[model samples]
Target: MRPLIGLDQVSVAFPGTLALDRVSLQVFPGDVLAVIGANGSGKTTLLTTLTGLRAPTGGTVVDADGPVRLRGPADALTRGVALVPQEPQLATSLPVWENLLIGHGGLRGAAPGRAARARARALVAEALPHVDPGTPAGQLRKADRAIVALLRAQSSRPKVLALDEPTAVLGDRGVEIVAEATSRLRAEGGAVVLVSHRLRDIVRLATRVAVLVDGRLVHDAPIGEVSVEELVETMAAGRPASAQVTARVTGERPSGGSAVPRAREHRLSVEVLAVRGLREHGLSVDELTVRAGEIVGLAGLAGSGRSRLCRLVAGASGGSAPVTFLGGPLPSDTRASRRAGIAYLPEDRANESVFAGLTVARNLEIADVVPAGLGTLFGPRPDRSRTARTISEFGIKTASHQTEITALSGGNQQRAVLARVLAHQPRLLVADEPTQGVDRTGRAAIHTMIRRFAESGGAVLVVSSEFEELQELADSLHVIRDGRVVARRPPDCEYRELVALATGARDEKEAEQ
Candidate 1:
């Protein structure tokens, strides 16, 4: 079949970098073609080119029948190509129904009209059962808002659907919904291009896979022919056996005592702030704590409130949760929590975390921009040259401290961010989804840092969706369900048992209780 979408030697350039370099790609009618690549590998640029938001510096982006010239986002939608961008900007002030309609050339039907109401309900039911059509979009959760945007796209039933990191904010069930929706679109003869870093989703849903690295097409093949590890190796430019080993060795600090010396070893310790009830999904945690020099892992499937719980402990949320540090209550704000020596690493680096436009130095120094007591009006105090040295000590590779944070590789960026947090030498670190989207080497480095933190009588609460991660790093595990801590296990907990708890699988022992 003729390709429904094609890119012939396409290239896109920014002021300082070539985003897409003489790259070519194609998608057949009804094909689920996934574009896989590392961060800054031009996946987004290629999608923008195909959707017409960006003009190619060279070659062309053809929609089988004709070229799609560079225009704005609206022009691309008008041409039957709808892009669900990674960050789905929504009109929060509007109702869910209105938001959906606004994306479809404004609301044609009145909100109270019978047909319009029914159509809106149908749209929500089909794409997002969790969202209320009558509710204002602003009141919805971030994930739910993303779902609404997706539904709006499907409502159009366009000839081509392009979703960039659609599952980034979704829970496990939400991921399934997106996968199912993409599959359904294929059945209707629509062309689909999915850009993602998750190999499992790509392998399961993609009919064909295209790998891009450094703005070049490195591999294009049937999904069945490639393994995720192989893809990782390709992205790294080779499958060297000792790559992980080298990273682990270099990342390791030293052996003062623990098996993984230099690994921060924290027994579970509690650092509370001003939070009451602290509820999001369903679980209610009242007075939580882990001893210092302990590794405590909170394991749950997405939507279990694991991420939210971590955020609360990190003092990111606005509401007050009565938190205690040591024996005394902490101040109700983040600044107070930090003053009490609490640090946090958030899960959503692209949104909730990350100051993208800042330089590596600036990003790392945000917490210390004005250390308390430097001056009430803000005056310089101690030199941060030591802090800069510590950043280098963490093995953060960059052209310079002034390098744009966005310019670093995903691993390096994460390390820089971590360095900033570590510079404070926090007594308690709450890491939420710390390794998501990082490479094997990056994961090792982060794990090493966390372990090292725990070793020095610090406390840690690690919440992760990946079971293997928790398994490798946690000395104790807490299973959370519907917003409650339902079970706890030693660090050597059985993987199957953990999985069963995460998925709500039960046996006779639980039934008897």
Candidate 2:
């Protein structure tokens, strides 16, 4: 079959980073090509190149019809190509229906007739029943926003679809929607290019798989020819491997009487934080606790209230939840939370956690120093020596402390954010999606930092969508559904069982039995 789109020896470079190097690939009609790579390995760059968001520095993009030069996203769209970005790109201020109608010319510009607008609304409603078309995009949860983006892209009916981690933030239902869309597109002879870290999704949706490492395509083969273990090994080693795998601890302690002593010891530990009557953003938790030196994980599908719960506990969200820290009543405010020795790492690190224009040292200092008012002569300055120490401790790679945080890669930026949060040495740490977009190395570093923090007598609560992440990093996990904790499992819980619990496929009783 003739390829619908092909990249011939493509190369893309940005300043110090060579994102993609002499990479060549093709997507044919009905082909679902999964692109797998570690963080910073150019999977996103490849998608951008194909979507015309970034033109390749070398090589040509050829369609079955002929060679094509894409000037911009619109040009690519005009040629029946569409991209669903990793991040939701909806207009937050606009109503959901308006956002969905953005590129379709149904509600804006030369406005379409009433019938056309109604048709668009019906399409969105049919495609995504969970999303309210009348709601403001910003008011909706993150997962809902992502769904809006997917529906918008699918509504275009592009001949070629490019999805960048479509299932990363989505729950089982969301994954089903995406899978259905892929099947429909394939049935209609359209092509798909998927970039994802979840090996399960790749195994389910991809017919062909391509591995990328250090900006180079290392392997390409049929999905049937490559196992999940092989993919993990290739990504971890950054090259093909033939060595036999060895089993490691599955993060579960021994059961029966052997585990009783440890469980009792943990229960007797001082409670670093406690919450009661917590309610915010449609999520409610009657009681939650984290003991000193414990790492607790909240696992749920997107929009299941995992992040919202974290924010509420961190005092970033307004709620009536009664919170206590270190046996004392805690006020529901950001400053109070910080003063009470609570550190929060928001999920939206790019915008919420880091100041892109500020120096790394300055960003780190903000954790300790508050900005002065107009009456004050000068604001607090960063302790240079302390900042230097933090840089080393967090393994943040930067030219200097004076370098802007935006200049670093996503993983480095995340590390900087973590370093800033940890500078205060809070008693409790609440991290949301800490390793969402980081590569294997970066994830290991972050995990190590979290583990070390807990080891140092601090309590940690992590909210993540990746089941395997929670399985590995969390000593205990809570599965949330519809804004409530439905099940609690040990770190050794089966991945499929955890998913089932989170999706409400099986209740806590059933899962336990």
Candidate 3:
């Protein structure tokens, strides 16, 4: 079978770094090639070069027998290649079907005709009926939006399709939807390039696999030849021997200590997170206590007032409440909350968390940017050596301290962000969806890290929609519904019980009054 797209000794260089080194690779018709690697492994650069986003600084891109060229995205599309990014952008104001066919199948300088709309509707119905064709893009759930993006890309019927961490952020159902769509494309004679760190995806979807380590394609093998353990070891150790690969990324603090160093090390009990009139935001509960060294979880549906409760406890409140920290009234402002040994992790990491476009080392210094005593405005220049040590201390794998934080994998990014948050040495951490989107190993590591924080005499208040995660990580869970605390359960509560409490128990009189 002939290759649909090929890279012959392609090298791409950015300032101060060679993103891709004389890497030769190919995608054949009907192929599903899974790309696996640690962060900064140049997987993304490979995809960009393949899709014409980055020009190769050396060698050539080829087709079957000779050199091939791509002028831009339009040119790549014409040459049978398309890229679906990690977070697919859509025209939020438009209807789902219109968003799917927005930029394609239209007259030059005119809107998409009715036949195009009809075609998009039919295609979605036949292939992905789960996605509502007429719903506004802004209103669709995260998974539905992703499905729509996949359908839109396939709408063009390209010979070779490249996906960058497509299922990284999706749950089981979302992953299944994407995997099925990919299978359909492969069975229909199209080639697919899947970049993912999720081991299950590689095992279940890829026909073959390749591993990239430090900008080089180090391992290429048939999916049947590699065990999951071998793949993990290979990615973690580059060329594996007998060492435990899981230790490298599995939530061991860079500065190693016993797992429960100071078991249940409580400094003091903070009482009564009471906010007068917070009932306006569905915050019906007036009080809860989070003693130091405890992991207290807030579980509920998206609009269940958990966020409001978290914001109140984390000091993002508009007005001061009776909430006490270390036996004193907690401050109302975010800055004061930080100074008072509290840190808040926002739900949206892409926009609210990490400092984008900054190097890993610089992003680590963000917590210190808080102004204190009118002496330092952005903290000290951050001892360059100390920041570097912090990265090692967190086991954040990056090619260099100078590398952009965004270049790291989703897991590493979470670690870096958590490291930054911990920089404050806060007594309490208000974490929202602490392990979202990370691979299973990464997920476990993050959980361990959070648990370690609590074990070290720091308290944690976790807000999550992932009931399973709460079950695994929380010491105790508070279920919220319509802004009221309906049930409090142990960490091992039944899944149905938590779901029923959070979503069922609607009648106010029937709940905890």
Please name the candidate that would achieve the greatest lDDT relative to the true structure. 2
Highest-TM-score candidate: 2
After aligning candidate 1 to the native by TM-score, how far in Å is the CA of 273 from where it should be?
14
TM-score, predicted candidate 3 vs. hidden true structure: 0.55
TM-scores for all predictions: 0.59, 0.64, 0.55
Mind sharing the TM-score for model 1?
Answer: 0.59
Model 3 regions more than 4 Å off: 106-111, 125-132, 238-340, 343-513
Q: Decide which is better by lDDT, 1 or 3.
A: 3
Ranking by TM-score: 2, 1, 3
Q: Provide the overall lDDT of each model, using Cα atoms, as 2-decimal numbers.
A: 0.70, 0.77, 0.73
Write model 1 residue lDDT over 1-513, tens digit each, in one string.
666677999988875568899998887877788897654578888988888778899998777676666477777677677888776678888888777666544456434556756887788766667666778788988778888888888877777899887776676775687777887888888888988765666777788889887689999988889876566656546323332223333445322212333223333434322234444433476535666776678987555668777766666663343545565655456776677678878887877567998887778777675246444686544356965796778878889888888898888888877777777888778888887777767777887788777776777788876654675677667776556666776544455455455434542245221
Backbone clash pairs in model 3 (N, Cα, C under 3 Å; residues 3+ apart or in different chains), count: 2
Instruction: Please give the TM-score that candidate 2 achieves against the real structure.
Output: 0.64
Clashing pairs in 3: 254-393, 282-483
